[model samples]
Structure formats: C-alpha cells, structure tokens
Target: MNWKKPITSSLKSLSLSIALVCAGTYIAHAETVGEPEKEELKFGFIKLTDMAPIAIAYENGYFEDEGLYVTIEAQANWKVLLNGVIDGTLDGAHMLAGQPIAATMGYGTKAHIITPFSMDLNGNAITVSNDIWKKMKPNIPKMADGRPVHPIKADSLKPVIESLASEGKPFKMGMVFPVSTHNYELRYWLAAGGIHPGYYAPHKGDNSGQIDAQALLSVTPPPQMPSTMEAGTIHGYCVGEPWNQQAVFKGIGVPVVTDYEIWKNNPEKVFGITAAFAEKYPNTTIRLTRALIRAAKWLDDNSNANRPAAVKILSQSNYVGADYDVIANSMTGTFEYEKGDKRAVPDFNVFFRYNATYPYYSDAIWYLTQMRRWGQISDDKSDQWYKDLAAKVYRPDIYAKAAQSLIDDKLIPANEFPDFTKENGFKAPQQHFIDDIVYDGNQPNAYLEKFKLGLKKGDKL
Candidate 1:
C-alpha cells in the first residue's frame, strides 16, 4: 500500500540528462542510446497478435539499435508471463493494461509492476458459440442482405440468458483474467444490456467474481477460447486476436462485437516491467521504450502499409502461432464479425497513432475505475486516491523521456508524439463506452457513480 515512493529516483532522473548529452555528440541530430547496463534481455509475451510491438522491435532491430540484445519468448498464459517478469526470469513482457494496475494496487499479485509503454489499442473481441449465436441472431436486427447488424449489443442475448435461467442453467462466459480489459469490457457490455455480470468481494474471500451473477464468467486463455467454447466449457469469451478470428475460421463461434465498438480506441496491452527493474536499469528502460515506440510507428506507418509483413511474422510458431490469414483478418485494417460479414475498421489495431504508446495517467485511471466499479477495490475511495494510485503505476515521466529521445534521434518524427511541454498526463474526458458513460480521469469517483451495476462511493458488495 505504500505507493508514495515515486517510481523514478535521482539516478533514474539523471539517465535522461546523460542520454541527452550523448545524443548531442553521437551523430548529426541523432540521439544515440548509451551502452545498456544489461545487454542480454529476454522479454515474455502471450501468443496474441497485440504482442506485435515486441516482435517487431526484435525483428526490425530496433532493440539492437539501442545497444540491447533481445530475446522474445511466448509465455504459457498471462500468469506465467507476469510471473516471468516479477521473478526476473523475463526482463519485461506484454501485459494486460489492468495487470500492472492490479498488481500495484494489491489485487491479485502484490508486486510493484509498472508500464512505460502501452503496446496497442482496440484488438480484442467478444465471441459466442454457434448455438448461442443462433439463439441471439433473431433478436439482432438484420441488414437487407440478411447479415446480422454490426456492433451487436448484448441486449440481443438477454432473452437467451433468461431462457437458460428458466431451465435452471447458468449462462456461462469467459474472459482471460479478473483484472483484464476483456473482463471489464464484457462485464460492461453485459451490464449495459441489463444483465448482471456479477461482482467480486475480495474482502469476503471470493476471487471467483461470480457473486449474484447472471452470466458466470471464468478465466480461459486466449488460444484456448474457441476450443473451450466448442467443448461447451463456456458459451463465449472476450479475448484478443487471432483467437476470435480463429473461432470464426474454425466455425465454432462468431464474434459478436469488437472492443473498439465497446469502447473506441480503448487502451489495450502495455509493456510491463517491475518498478525495481525500472529503477535499477533506468537507461535500459528508456532505451527499450524508444525501441518499442519505433516498432509501433512501423506497425501503423503508411496507413498500416507494414501490416502484411507484420502478420507474416506473427504467424511464426514462436510468435502468435496462428495462420497468416487468421492474424490478418483483423490486423490488416478490417475485422470479420461473422463469416462472410467482414467490415472495414481501419482503427481496429492501432499501435502508434492517436498517441497509443504513451503511458497516459488517464488510461491507468480508467482501469482503476473499472476495478472500483466491479468491487475489486472493495471500498469507496477519494478522487485524489485514484489519481495518486494512477500516478504511482503509470510513468508518463519515463514515457516523456523516451519520446523526447526518439525525437532527438530523428528516428521518429516529432509530430508523431504528444507535446511533452503541455502534456499533463490526463486526456480530455472520454465518452466512447457502449453504455454512453462519459469518463473524465480527474473525476473517477464521479465516473464510478455513473455505473448502475458497479460499486461507487459509500457502496459495498
């Protein structure tokens, strides 16, 4: 609970000054990184396409250019990936945006995890089994061509849930983790449609998060989602691609909606490292961020001109381990909602543009608000407390230093990043949730108050 100690220290602050000085003499208008304190670095990631930044950084030599020798390995799942970083087996990893927030807040793991870079935005989707889709299809309005309408709302599934309830069967669903964005987004979508996705009473020793539930959600890894649903273990799941598209390809399930429709340009995965790692290797931390920033720019460059090449790499067994077409279904600026119902959604997988890589405090606050909203926080908290906790976990100061160095290196155009001078870390109020809720980071307690199905100030489960 001692989040008061700043994630950065005097030595960490000095690393930026030193990098700037070295940039002046290294090359004409080029900011060169110093020799890394640790050169042999191994990073961990789950087998999801959102881990593209890390793979691209390694394949494109962005990491080597920063004097870092990197090895990228696929972890078994989120817990293994997080544990790899926490135990120092992996230097850093692609993480759920909520993992660091939850870890720092003492929700599941009590480690001080921090993220200097957000990996990408809007790459997850909610998919349902063929049977459930068949039942929900009648409720969803169809286009003239008989295609189910896009951005399918969970309201269409309510009658199905009720029917199952009448038969004394629980409506089952899956998300990757308790604190994952997938879990929150699925819960939000279900609740917006008047279905109680349920809550967690950690204080009551229930991490099950199934207290008073209508749709019972459980953890299922990304790659296993389609098979799990196929086996009737769960009816559907919310997970990042190519798992969703894999379901569509296998003909086992149909994706109901994308996270983009749930919350536009929502912050997704982040590059997470321990606070101890950041403090001990400040130069390495900034250097890796710079590399990742470049990789992200490449992914979104020329209006995603590099996606085909990126998808080819992600299809490798050591990376996402999915077919190129499955990865490309969404990564190439379009998404397949139902088979033969593909649609153009250019912003479906944003890496760099819209300042997607910057570790914004507002992004951190949103996840914290969801935790509070769903009773994971377990108590009412002051607005300032939310703000303080966000500041502790999201290191925009580190992000700023890394960004400025990229600008200095002329590696990425200065215009590609946020204006560090005027940046106060909080984004303007976001109003993109499917529920029509407006979220202002500075007023998190107020934001939580707006949700009918979640905990708010003075409310306990």
Candidate 2:
C-alpha cells in the first residue's frame, strides 16, 4: 500500500547516501594517488639479490595495484642499467647507492638521477680466492670449534698483501663499480686494517684509484666476481650476493666479511630514476614508489616468511639467474662464509625493517663523504655542498608522499616509518663501522677528519 511507497523511497535515499560515501572514498584515493601517468614501464636491474624489491613489486602485483604494468630487465651491468635510465630505455633502475650521488655530482654520466627508495641494507661481502683464503686462514683467530671467528677483519689479509708485494706481485681486488657501495666498503675495510685501498685523483685524470695503494682495487661486475677471482684475475672481491654465496657453493673462495659487519645495516642499493622522469610523470613516480614500498614490506614481513618464495622468484632465469640454494644462502637470513660454516645473519638482506626503504639524506651524505674521501669529488666540499647534493639526489620528500599515502590507506602502520613530522632526513650518529669510526651525517667535513686513511680538510687528490 502507501507503506510500500515509503519503504521504496527510503531504500533509494539509502542507496544515494551509500553512493555519495563511495564517491567520497574514491575521490580521496584519487587524491592520494592519481592515475599513473605512464602505465607500461620498463625497469632495469643488475642480477643481484637486492633487486628483489623490483622483482617482488612486479611479481606480487603491487605495481598492478598502483595501475602500473612493469617490465623488469636484467641489464648487462650497472652502467648499462644507469644508461638505460638516462636514455629513457628504462624508466628506473635498481642502482648502487653511489650511482645517483656520483651522477648528480657529475663524477660519471652527468645526469640528474634521484632515488625515492633505498632498496636494502647490508647485502655485500668481501671474498678472497681459495689460495688467498688458505694463506689467510692461519692468520684468522679461530673459535674453540676451529671455526674462524665472526666478522673477520681485513687485518688477517694484510700480511698476505705485504708478502705478495715483497714478491713483486700487485695485490689486486675487484669491486662492482667505481662509485659502488662495494668499492667504498672494500676500501673502508682495507683502510681500517692499515692497508690502503688507493685513491682516485679524477682532477689529475687519474681515475684508476691506485695512487699509493697497498691493495689494488679495480672494477669487476658482480656476477663476474666469483669467476674473476677463481681465474686468479683478482685475489679478492667485494660484491653483493649471490656471487659471494656462489663462491661458497663452488668452493672457489671464502667470504671473509659482509658489509653488515663492515658497517652494520649500511645502506646499499636504491631505486633510481632520472630527475626529469620524476618531474614529467609525478604520478608514475609516486605510484612506483608506492609499489616498491609495498614490496619491501612484503619482503621483510612476518620475519621474512616470504623470503623462500622470493628466493625462488629470484632464482628464475629472467631474474637473478642463480640457483635457488645459492640465492637462499643469504636471502633467507643465514650467510655462508666458508664451506659448512653457515651462520645466521638475520639482517643480511633487510628490505623494509629499520625503515630501509626511506631515502634519507644521511644515507646520501654517507656516499658523498665516501666520494670525497676516495677522491671521486676530487676537492673539498662544504658541509652545505653535501646537504645540497644530498637533497638533490635522495628525494625523501617523494618517499614521504608515497609512505604516508600507504599509511592513510591503512596498508602499513605509522610506527613502521620514521616520523614524517619530525624527520630531518638525518639519521642519528651511526657508530657501527668496522673501524669504529663515528659518522655524523650532518657534519661531513668533521666526519672526514675522523678517518685516518681518507682525505681531510684542505686535502685534494
């Protein structure tokens, strides 16, 4: 009767109210992340386990969730990957933490590249060839079980280098790139042990980085590290997994120390895109950051419950291309130093924990300080110069935008990230270096003065 008409009207009103609420929610989400400006994208990465964030973002549909269709290509090397990003062949890349910093500073491939996400922390190790390890073994302090003590310092190798030097042989080691974290880490380790890893005087057109070096350090791509050392082309190398693990599996070398031991939870790779790309496709930039953030969280979620699956994905031919066991040796929370000397290193490959995804200016400054310390900058830079360069390359502004949107969507907790309201982009003074040097990112020059082996104020390479 008439009651039926009233009921129908109420139902229509309720439907309209619900529709309005849904529209409001949709509008909020749209404001949070607009439609991606570029849908189909290509990203480049070297075949290392830290590239897991990119692979996971694509495979786990996080990119799809942000309306992005991504194609991941494993590049021939870091330079190729960086060049692809520079030339527009790749929209972004999993880059060495130093690549963007060095690029922005005009050290190599003068282009304005920036990172909104730090990929992972502490995934590199320095491995010595079997012959070298055999020589070094007697020098290392052994535990009661006859196993070498953890965090084996480069001091154990110093005598070996000296002996080689006396024999008129150049003690050579390999790092991935000129500005790679591996290079800096190796140099740090060597210098800490009273062995000079050399310096580069780019100003003098001396890019070899062998000026008065005790241990000659040169570039060798990550995947080639094990082979290069096995072939005796290099005595040792600092590289990321699964190459270090590959050496362990092949019994060609023994990993002496990891970057985590060299510098605890040190920043490693970053997701890099040209600054022009970020400006041209802001939505795509943030959306990709969002996808990477989600992937990082997934990687470290539930105490790394997802790593076995991640290792399987990385082991596929198109990705890291290493065997599953090789990648899993480190990716699953344990790292093998020597054959049958596997030990738990839970943070060996941190993806999200400790705010690993945040692109801190402090992290950028660390790399810049290293560049200056190692003579890549070739001259003194003011503290302000470091902050300015760091601001240009490490875009935590972009990171906060992406991270906060995720928080707004209730996908992640606020406590999981640094307090955006209070984050000044500088981490607290880090004191975990192998040499026990303190790094205060706000004071780059001061930090440089603390290093006994690096250039200091008024010093030029």
Candidate 3:
C-alpha cells in the first residue's frame, strides 16, 4: 500500500508551509541528525474505529509531510500486531495502552515496549446479547418517555448472572486481548457494580482471570465480537467502536454503556515500539511521532470538521472494513444504544481534544493499578514502584521532544499541550469512574484499597 504516492502533492504544500516557518532551525537540526533514519515504514492496526488516527494520518498526507512513507496494515489480532512490532516486521503499531505496559512488565510477552502517543479516548462500550439486555432491562430505571436511562451500570446485570449461576451455567463475556484496555475497563465496570470480575493470578499458573469471578471474561478478536455474541458463545462483550455498533446494526445485541461512562476521558489506543527500536532509530521515532501528532491535531481541529471524511476513509475495505453507517454510528459524534435511539455524544470518539495526544504517566499508572488489582501484576508493590514502572514505559520525555519540534515549527500552539515547565507527567486526581471513586494517580496503592472486589495490598496470587 503506497500510502505516500496518493498524498504526495498535498504533502508538498505542507512541506512548504512547515519549511517557511522553521527553515533555519530545520537546517541546523538537519546538519546534526540528517534525514529520518527510516522513511518507508509498515504499521499495523486492528479493524476498530480507534485505529482511525492511523488511517487518517495516511490518507491526509501527515506521514508524507514528515519526509516518510507509511504502510498501514490490519492485523488478525492484537498478539500478531504486537509481535510484528517486537520482531521488526512492523515499524510500529496502534496498540492497547495496556499492551505496552503489560509487555514491559513481563505479564505475558516480555518486551521493552514504549508509547510516545495515545491514539484516542473513550471509544469503547459494553454490549449484551438481546436476551441478556431483555433480562437486565427490567431492573433499569426508565426516563419519563420510557427510554431506558443511559450510562447503564453493570448492577443491572447482576440478577442475570445470579439466575445463570443458579442454573449452573457460566456467564461468559468477551474482550479483545488479555492486556487490552477492553479487558481492564470491563473488569473495572463489573467490579464497581459489586460483581467480582476475577483476577489473573499468573504466579499460581492461572492466567484465565476466572479466579472468584461472577462473569467470566475471555479474549475474542475485535472483528468477531458481534458474531460470537450472536452465536451464543458469549452473552456480553466490551470492545472498541464499530463492533458494538455492528451488534446494533445486526440486531443481535445492544450496547448497554460506553467506557466514557465507565471512566471519563480514559486513554484507549497507543502507538507502540520496542525500546531497542526507539534507541536505534531515534530520528525515525520522532519523525513518526511528528506525523501522528499532525494527524491527531487534524482529527480534532475546527471542532472535528474533518471527522466525516475520516469516517469515509476508515470505512474503506482495507481499513476498518465495516459498513460506513456502522462506523459512523459512533465516529460522527453520535452513539446509538438501540435502533432509532441515537443521541448526541460529542466526545464519543476524541482524537486530539483534552490533550489526548499527550501520553500521561497517570494514564499509564491507572492501567497498571488495574493490572495489579486483577492479578496481572501477580504481586503487591509500593506506589513508587508503580510510578517508576510507568516512567520507564510511558515516555512523556520523548513526547515532549516531538511536541516541542511541532511547536517550534508552529504546527501546534503551546497552550494546547501541558505546561511542560511544571509538568511531572501525572494528571491531578480524577473523580469520574462509574463508581464515583476518586482516583489519585500518585497514590495508586491507596486507590487499589478502595476497590471491594479486586486484590488488595499484600495479597498474593
């Protein structure tokens, strides 16, 4: 896929604009670093709407403007995609934020993975089979118009699980990857509802995450979520956009709630590469970040003026491959819980707003705490340990370098980013979980103790 050839002409104009702003600084920097080390690059993504940034970057000449050529490929699953980056088959990938964190911590595939950019925020939802939704709807409060009140918490599903348990049937659910944000977010929502979603307990040789769980969660590829739910293999699922909408389109299930309602402005996907790759291709890393940053800015500029066109590109067969309407259900600033129940959800899929591009240490630590709570961390650790691990994996230092270059080139304003001078990469205390439990990122251990269902301090696998 010659991503550059189609956009070369537009890139020329972008290059002219960029050159005019920082020609002198660019010349000096060029003398020191030369051109980008790697120009022709292959990137991998899963067929989910959050992968839109990569497709938009390729389609909008963002990569070409950075003096690079990019090929974006959709992988079969997250494991294959991550392995491609680790083995040098893919230059980088749109990964679950937890992928880089878990891999670096040796939870599953030990690799020195790092993410300089977060792709988007709040692009996931929890969907239930039609039968399950019907069973749960009776417990839900309805509006005066009789439309079910939204932001439906998992408490509604408790009776369904209890009935299944009395019948000796296992209530099953699906998530994309073991270390995926989908898994942790689903677990977080379930636990908040007083339903134990279980733990990994890898030290005990049980990585299934069904230890003391009410609803058993397992891995299912993103594309297969709808069909698997329809076939009765799973009763419910939590996944990124398009797939959940696919269920509504197919009439097999209904999305009960979105992750936005689970945790506001939560980090979703990330651009991941090996630490060795970062060190070996420092210029290549920054250039790639620059391209992606531009793509992100364009995705959110002018109050999302470019989203309709991005929705078109993402609907193409080689990209997300879902029907345009299904992709647009959540992509174009609206989300549909049931057919004909569409409502405005402006932030349903945010790419650049609210400093979405900046990879915060707080975001990384949140995922790590979830990992520890769910037993993926396998043992207890101090708060400083969590912070140190996040610093090692989520490289805000490299992100600053990329953003500074863009700022120096006048591509983005300084106010749009964190105040780099006083920034410590940690966000202030967030109080937006579905359970309303305050999350202070600096005090991860204390936050973990507040959870009623998950592993607590000094608890072993």
TM-score of model 3 (CA atoms)? 0.94
User: Once model 1 is optimally superposed onto the true structure by TM-score, how far is the C-alpha of residue 276 displaced, in angstroms?
Assistant: 1.1
In model 2, pairs of residues that clash are none
Clashes of each: 1, 0, 0
- lDDT (Cα atoms) of all candidates against the true structure: 0.88, 0.89, 0.87
- Full candidate order by TM-score, most accurate first: 3, 2, 1
What is the clash tally of candidate 2?
0
* Candidates' RMSD to native: 6.3, 7.6, 3.6
In candidate 3, position 424 carries an lDDT of 93
Show where candidate 3 strays beyond 4 Å. Answer: 5-34
Give residue 124's error in model 1 in angstroms. Answer: 0.4
Candidate 1 vs candidate 3: the lDDT winner is: 1
Per-residue lDDT of 337 in model 1? 80
lDDT of model 2 at position 77: 90
